[model samples]
Structures are given as structure tokens and as C-alpha cells.
Target: MSSSGIWQPANDFRRVVFWRHGRTLWNAEQRFQGQADIELDDVGRAQADKAAALLAAVGPARLVSSDLRRAKATAQALADLTGLDISTDPRLRETYAGSWQGLTFEQIADDYPTDLLRWERDDISVRAGGGETRIEVAERMRDGVLEALSGVESGETLIVATHGGAARVAIARLMGLPYEYWGTLSGLSNCNWSVLQETGNARNPGAEGSWKLTEHNAGTLPEPQTEPVED
Candidate 1:
């Protein structure tokens, strides 16, 4: 114990389930929503309903969401099912696409080809439409996840409802990866979630504890394997 009588490196391990928002019209069109505040389409709402039913079965203790409309709507489904209040954080928002916000992939490729190329090359400093770089997105997202971790107790699950880009950056940052390696983790599909469990070690103590990826992009219930008898 420290002289201050506080637990070093925090008091407990935690579980974070990072949920990607359901589909939007732009998502179907392959347009980048970024921070555009697009709401969910009808199909998206249905996806959220089914996904929430499954997630609520696990009974997450806390719920935090990106302030964007699409994310909020998806989170709301879970909140409704679980009867848990929703907390919104702007830092959980997607990487801003800046000038590419409303443009299709082909449009951006034809017009802002240089920027798109840099982004595709994993240029951490490259901005899309003067929007945030991968590093900037990582830093802010790390802040939100860390803060969320600090607020929740050990063993309690924190359901973070955020965008695909933001969730990847946050998870990569928590996993202690350099910004360049963020691309190794695939973007989550709509209404899917990734799980990170805090597995702290008493042997080594730090303000931020270690996390493990127990699951990634899980959307459906698990299937039980049936054994063949009397072949």
C-alpha cells in the first residue's frame, strides 16, 4: 500500500465491451460518416434491437456512448433493454473525415486522391478533409476509455457504444500498440462488439492496467457443439 493509503495502479480489473453502432444510410453507400451525426436507418434500428437483446442478456453494469445520433440510437436500444441510463461522450466519436464527410469513396479517391492515399498508407499524420489523424483519434479515444475504466469497479462490465474508427483506435491504444499498427485490427461491422478484459498483475503495478482481447466483432450467440453418438 502507498503512504496515501490508496490502491496502486487501481483497485480492480474490468471488462469493456466496445460496441459499434448499427448501419446508417451512408454506411450502406460506403460514405464516411465521421462526426456527421447521421441517424440509423430502419434496418439499423432492427439490428440494434436484436443486438441489444443479446447484449442485455449479459447484463452490462455501465453504458457509455458516442454523442453521434447513430451511436446514441444503438446505445438507446441496449439502455432500454437493460434499463440502464446512457452516458454520452464526444471523445468516443468517430475520426472526423473533415472534407470527406459527405463524399463517397470514389469521390474522395478521384478528388482528394493524395489524402486518401496517405490514409491508406497508414500515415498517422495524414488528415482526411482536414480532419483528425489516426494518432489524434487514438489519444482522445484513449482518454475516454481510461476515464471509463477508472469509473467502473473490477469485474463490472462497461459497454462503450462508439463508432468503428473510434473503437478501433481506443482498443489499439489500450492494447499498447503504436498508431501504425492500428490497421491490423479490422473495422468492426455494424452492431458487433469487441471485448477487452483487464487482467492486472500484482507483480507489476501501473496507473493503467493491462487488458486482453477476449472477443472481437462478436454479434451472434454461440452455437453449442453436438457430439455424434452411435455412428
Candidate 2:
């Protein structure tokens, strides 16, 4: 009902639920998985199912997801549960790790210690060899989130699935956290979901608005136990 022809703002306004994709083989390996196209592991599939069930409980009107296989797979599970088709956006993809794509953290530390240390210190512009800078990742993620918000009218609920680092950037920006504190934020678990609320006057979509983080890294289902069970 707004100018964009999207649904009109109800008194309740809109909410966004951001979900991190389920676990992958690389995740189990504790590898830097950026931009790598690994599929979900068996446990990851169960995680996706749990996430979908969780989103269904909240009842979002639309589902949006990163175009990457891991994210899409996770989003699709939720979409199927909620009977909503997913709208994929490549902009939501994870930060490109470049040369570090398939390497483990320990390996990166050993091979690129200085870069790793700088990154840990929150250098927004630091780049791993052939990798993306934090600034670049933030900018694209911010633009993608803002664009998604603009497309929907006030009061519409949206669900988005993306990667850990990208999720961190998006959440930090939405909550107005300091750029340096990006590391302070908790890492998102596979299939975990976070809820954010947006408020603004429907008359002016671009007008000053308030965004709040209602939930942070909450999962619909329990994480698969990595520890071995005792007999």
C-alpha cells in the first residue's frame, strides 16, 4: 500500500529474521570457508530443518537468502516450512576469503600471522592475500540489507540466510555497533536466527528510523553435539 506497491505498514511494523546457514564439512574442519561452495554436511541438514521449524513458528511473510548453496539450502528449508518462496541475492554472500577460502584458522595463523593478527584487531581495510577487506564486505552487506528493507513496506516480516562473517557485519551495522567492535559480537552458529525490528514513518521511507536487535544468534533447534557420547 506504500509507493513501492508493497504491503502497507501495520501498527506493529516489520521484523527481519537473519539466519546463518547450517554446518558444512568445512565448518567441522574449522576452516575459513569464505566464498567456498561447500554443501551442508548431514548434521547441517538437520540443523536446517530445525531452523525452518523455528521460523515457521514466527510466521514471516517472505524469505530472502544468499545465493550460495549453503545459504540457499538453509533458506529453502524454512521457505518450504512456511510455504514462502525464497528470493536469492548474491549480495548477501559471505566475505571473499580469497586465498584463505579453504584453509583452517590454525593454518592461516601459521601462514599469514601478521594479516590474521591485524584482522583480529579489527582493521576494516586489512586484506588477506587475494581476499576482501572488511570495508568492502561491510559496504556490500549494508547496501544489500538496506535495499531489501526498502523493497518491503513497513510491517512486513522478512527472513534472510547468510554466512557467519557476513551475518556479523549485517548485525553490527543494524544495531549501530562500532566498527571496531565487530569482533566483540558473538559468532553466529549454523542455522541460528536473529530478530531485528525496523521503525519509520511510512510517509517517508528514507526518513530517520530506528532499528533494534530483539534477538541475537538464537537457534530454533539445538546444535548437533560435536562431542562423542559415552557408552
Candidate 3:
């Protein structure tokens, strides 16, 4: 652990940052994107440019992104600064909200109230729009992240550009949180990111330790964790 009471990756360890894509028209309009393959709007491009500068300073070694245009675009910004090749993975795409794609929250509430409620409740079996459940998404996300991390060397940082919902679920799974408690973690805002430090070699199958969430929904660089003090 570092002096800030937060665990920092040692020379033998690695770090992973899950970055959410910037705002799209649907995102700005409060519509459910859910693997719709939307591109970043003008404002989103600006957001990515700013964020890429900061993230680039940290010296990320590799970039992996969802195959969707929005995520690919966001990763491209950081790649431009870092000069790292981007690897796109379809498994990192947002939850496929089958019939619910392209609808607003209000529309889903009115049309599929029960399913919406179940989704909000984090029901593992509840598949919004007859799409994959949270568990399914989590599994695929875990696999994709692990596959990407396999190439990451110690003391290196791997950045993942993905959608908000996909990032949250993957974070929860990577942290070993149960599916029902996934909602406890706040959602990521557009262009914000979460950081996870490896406690063990999660890249190796059946590794000893889990990935610990060091930061969440952050626009700035990570700060030290505040620990309790004794008088």
C-alpha cells in the first residue's frame, strides 16, 4: 500500500482502468443505448480529448475497447496520446437490451414496467427486452477483461473503453461482488472512469487475490484512499 493508505500496484503488479464512453445523442436524450452502436457526439469528442490527456499522463500500455463505435472512439483518443494499438472485443459491448433498444427510461417504465423494475432491482434472471441478464453480461465481461489482461505485463496499465452499464457490471464481477448487490455501486457518468488494482494475478486462472476497486466515476486522477485513524 502507498502512503495514502491505498493499495498501489507494485512493480510486480498491474492496474486496470475501466473508462466509460463519452456522451452520445441517445445518452444526452436519456435513451437506453444498450449495444446500439452509437457514435460520440461533438461534445463527447471534446470530453474524450480532455480525458485522454490526463489518462495519457499515467502511461497506459494497452487499450482495449468495446467494438461499438462510441467505445472505439473513446479508446482512440487515449491511443492517439499513448500510441498504443486498440483491440476491440465484442464481449465488452453493452448489455443487449433486445426489444428495449433505442427507448428512453420513461418509455421503458411505461411499456415494460415489470421488466424495468426487475432490471432496476438487479434481478439476475431478469432480461430486459429479452436480452441477456446481468449475470450473463458479467460473465462475458469477466472473460474479456481476463483475456486482455493476459498480455499486460507487471507495472503496466491497461485501459478498457466500454459502455456505462457494461463497465459497472464488469467492475462488480471483477471485485467479486454478488450480482444482487451490483446496484450498490453507482453508475458511471459519460467520460468518467473507475480504477481497479490487482490484489493478485487475476490474469491467471484461479488467482489468489481479487481486483480491488480503487476509484469510481472519476473525472480526475485517482486519490489516496482515506483510512480510519486512531486517536
Candidate 4:
């Protein structure tokens, strides 16, 4: 605790809430949507509405989303509540999965067994369906997020409405995790979100600091924890 009882680091760091869009018919069908621009289903709309209300309490200062339909729709739910304009970025879109984009999990597994296994193992070099490598996705996701953060001032929050894969890689990239460790983070469920706070260490002024994962795959608001900090 600081002398003034303030979380002093709050002034130095920025909070980012990375939210996954709601479910789509493709998602329910276990098909890969990738950057296919699928819309949310009925249940997805309800989930977005429910999640938006809870997230609004966080008082986000900036809202950004992928240019894809599902992600745009998800961002709109929160925009309607907060009256914040949604800034769309194609770089924030899901990885372009090429031949695997519209295929079901079973289909991909049956057809591209080797590639699928590599992907599942988080091989940064393997290009799924001969598409973007995990490193490529992470690079773009990192660029998009850093661009969004440029507009956000210290002590304010930025909400990124993006896809599950994009969100995972982005979070991992922001936290400075190795590409091999990216798979350790679980995929987010529909309409769930994760939170990251900047570490505010001594680094280049314009460079983003290492971020700490504060929350992951959360459907409900984060509660204060009084547990002892582990080494």
C-alpha cells in the first residue's frame, strides 16, 4: 500500500479487457469461422446483452473491435450501453485459417491430421490449413492491441471485442509469454472476457510494458481477492 492508501501503480498502468464475441452457428456446429464474418446466433445475442451490462460497470474509456460481423455485433452490445463508439480494425480479426476456415473440427482432424496436431500443440511454425502461423496471428494481434492502447491514457480502460483465438494470442503476446507457452492459456467461452494490466516497469516510454493477466475466461465481474500473493 502506498502512503496515501492509493494503488499507486494504477496511475502508471492501463487496464485492458479483452472480450471474446458471442457464439455463432458455426461455433455451435464446431466449425472454424476464422475470418468468415459469421453473425451471432439467438443465444449469442442474449449472452452479449448479459455480458455487456456487467462490463459496463467497469467504465471502459475506449472500445475497439475486429471488423468481422460477429465481433462487431458483440462490440455493439457494449457500445449501446456505454454510448462509446466502436473502432474497427481488421488486424484484430481472427486468423485467416484458409482451407480450415469453414471446416468442422472432425473434418479438419480427418483431413489435416498432421497440421491439426501441430496446431493443437501450439507449434508456432505450423500454418494451419496452409494459412497464417500462430506467430503471424500473434504479431498482428499484438500490433492491433498496441495501436488501440496508444489512444488510451494511463489509468483508463480499453475494451477489445475480438475472437477467441485472437484474444488468446493477443493476451499471451502482451504478457510477454513465449510462443510455446501460448497454448497454456485456455480458449475463452462465448461472450467471456479476460483482463490484463500493464506492469509499468522501467522500459522505453513508447513501448508497452509487460502485462499481467488479472482475469481469464470470466463471465462474471472480477471480485477482490484477499488471498496471499504466491511467489
Candidate 5:
């Protein structure tokens, strides 16, 4: 695992499990719920429960999540199953959608087509009214991931619950993918889980160790399920 400070991996450690929070009321409405703090829908709750079950099977050592309600709720479910404490960090929150919050894609396109188009083009500087720019979102998310990894020892596994946009940006930054292609990747399904591994020198890290995408869009659990929310 790469090290920027005193934290050194006991081994060539680098593995992270990225889980997208379950469906939300906004998600059901096909709206841009960035940083809006919406709760998960019933299906979303079920998704979180299923995610917890799957994660329990793998047994992660640590659990981290965005401070948003959706993400926190999802993390809690996993925490309950694995007996790991859930930690919240604002840096992991979803991309800020500014004035676009609660608006569906069709609405945004109808009202802010030019702005929407610019976003689609991956303009890092473009801001949707009160929303954050792509660059700003990327920086915060990078910091959050690094911070979360700092506390982990080499070979220790971590589970992070986050939003769709944030998850995409985080993975893009980690893999050194170009920002322009950020929107090209497949959208993470609600409650879907992805895995990444960290490796390399304690002082420096590279993506060369072993990074793989595990389960994606795994379905919901049965009744009385727990779920996650955005931070």
C-alpha cells in the first residue's frame, strides 16, 4: 500500500470495497439527489441488507461511509453484520448538485440544457448553480479515500459506502482514469459493491498491486432489512 506518512502497511496491502448506497426516494424519482440527504426507499433498504449479507461473507476489517444519511444508514447495516464500527467523513459525500438538487434529468435538461451538456462533457470547472465543480468534488473525495486508507494496516480490508457520482469520481482518480471519461463508465446500481486493492511501497503507492471490481448492483435483501444513506 502507498504511504504518505508514518502509516506503513504490514504487507503489500491495498484492498478496498466500494459500496454504493441503496435506492432512495429521489433515486426512485430519477432525480439528482446530490447532497440532498434523502432517505432510502424500501427497495434501497433491502439492497443495503443484501449488501450487508454479502459483505458479512467476505468480512471486512473496517467500515467507512460518507456523512450523508443514505451512506451512513448503509454503512450501519454492514457494521451490524460484521461487528465493525462505522465511521463517517464528509469528504466522502456525494457530488454537490447545487440548485439542481431534487431535480430529475429531464427537468435539468429542460431548464439547464447548456449546463447539463457542459457537465456531460466533463468540464471540471462547470458548476450547477450552488453545486460543486468536478475538480472540487474530486479533490475532496481523493482526500477522503486517502484518509480512510491511512488508518488501515497493510492487508486490512475496508468497506466504504458512498454515492454514485462520488464513487465514480473516486474510482476514476484511484485508477488514474481521465476525468473526461468519468461519465462514460457504467452507473453503479443502488447498493452495488465494488472492490479495489492497494499495494506498493509504504511511502509511495501505485495501482499496480491488484485492483479488481467485485460484485456490482447486487440485489436487495429480505424483509426487516437495513440500508445506507448519502453522507
Candidate 6:
């Protein structure tokens, strides 16, 4: 925690594992979860168990997750494996779907045709159900992620369990990708993960704390991780 009672990110804590939560009934049905609190189905639980086993091998120093049941349950798998407690943050929750919360993709398309078309174009300004825009989601998610990183020890790895849309925003933000290019990054599948490593000297404020994307949407256990590109 920092002077403002928020996590102040530091350069020394560099490694990050972005884990997407396991599947849910809505997910299988193509329903938008948004900020809805939904639990994992049986297969989803099994997926978490398998993913946690793989992530544990990475020796994570901390575990952070969204408070949503799906994400919480997914993070619980890693917590059980690493014996590290879980820290939940509402900021890390999924994109607020607003009126689209429980609606299936087909329904959203049939009803909100204009909005659906805008979403397909990856327009950051388009708000589903008059909910959060991509920019808003990215900024809040970035804050939540940096805060979690600030709480970990130097050179330690942290696993962040969250939702698909939310995870992509965080990844794009960390990669320093421009807002317009946010559409270039796709969402992660259930139980898949990505890794981001910090590069450069801890003392160099600007040079330090830069991130590289080492892995993305990995379904199997990851091999020895490599450093992300130093930007």
C-alpha cells in the first residue's frame, strides 16, 4: 500500500501472469457476463484446477483476483496450489454489460443492432447498455493491476485472475498500446493465460517497470518464460 492507501507500483516487482477465469453457463451460451456475479460450472472448476497446477510451477509471489464468483473461484485454485492468500478488487471485475448483462450475443445483436455493429468495429466509445467504454475499462483495470503489483515483493511473480474483457484491457494497457489499437488485442479464452515481465533497472524510473508480453492464451503449461520486449 502507498501513502494514498492504494498500491503504488514499483519496478522491482516485475513478473505478471494474467489468468482468465474458467467457463460459466453464460459463457457457453454466449451471454455477456459483464459485472454479473456468476459461479463457475463443473467443467470450469476443473479448468481452474488444471490451470492452477500449471501456474503454481511458476512460483507466484502473490495472487490477485476479481471479486466476481467466477474469478474468485479460479483464483482460489492458484491460492490452494501456491498456499498464497487471494486479494480481490472490484476494479478488476469484468466490463459492465449494463442492459446486456444476461443477454446472449444473438439477442444483443438483434436488439442493439447499432451498438452491436459498433462493438464489432471495436469502437472504444460504444457503451453496451450505456455501460463502460473500452477506455474506462482499460484505465480502471490498469490501476487495479498496478496496485496489485505494488504489494508483491521484489522480483516476485504475481498471478491475476480476472475476466476475459477485463484481462485484455489490462494487457493492452501494460503493453502501452494506443487506445485506437486496443482492438488489435483479442480476448483470452477460459482458463488460458498470458505472462508479462518487467524489464530494465529498478532505479531508472522511466526505464524500469516496462513490460513485455511473453505468452498469450496458453492452454498447456508454459515453458521457461522469456523477457518481454523492452519498449
Which digits, one per residue and each the tens of the lDDT, describe model 2 over residues 1-231? 433222333567777777889888888887888887889989989989876875676667777888989999998898777788888888898888778878888888899998888876768878855688776776787677777776666567778888877877676776666787777766677887677677554243333335666677775455543311000
- Write one digit per residue (lDDT tens) for candidate 6, span 1-231: 333222324546467888988878887777877898989999889989988887777678889999999999999988887789999999988888789888887788799999877865658888867898877887898888888877777778888998888888778877777777866766677888877777664333123236777777776534322211100
Off by over 4 Å in 5: 1-12, 199-203, 206-231
TM-score of 6: 0.85
Candidate 4, 99-192: lDDT as tens digits: 8988888898899989888887888888877788888988898888888888888777899999888888888888878778887888788888
Clashing pairs in 1: 99-129
Score residue 5 of candidate 5 by CA lDDT. 18
**Range of the 10 consecutive residues with the lowest summed lDDT in candidate 1:** 222-231
Kindly list the per-residue Cα lDDT of model 3 for residues 1-231, writing each as its tens digit: 543333345556678899988878887777888888889999889889878887887778889999999999999999988899999999999999988888888888899999888888789899968988988988898899888988888888889998888888888888878767788887777787899887755555334247888888877434221210000
How do the predictions measure up, each by TM-score?
A: 0.85, 0.85, 0.88, 0.88, 0.83, 0.85
Q: Best candidate per lDDT, number?
A: 3
RMSD of each: 9.9, 6.7, 6.6, 6.6, 6.9, 8.2
Candidate 1, 3-29: lDDT as tens digits = 422122333557788998888888878
Off by over 4 Å in 3: 1-11, 200-209, 220-231
Error of 3 at 55 (Å): 0.6
Displacement of residue 169 (Cα, Å) in model 5 is 0.6
Choose 4 or 6, whichever is better by TM-score. 4
Please provide, for model 5 over 121-219, each residue's C-alpha lDDT reduced to its tens digit, 9 standing for 90 to 100: 778878865578877877788778778887777677788899877776676666566777666555567787566655333345434223434344343
Of candidates 6 and 3, the better by TM-score: 3
Tell me the number of clashing residue pairs for each predicted model.
1, 1, 0, 0, 20, 1
In order, candidate lDDTs are: 0.76, 0.73, 0.80, 0.79, 0.71, 0.76
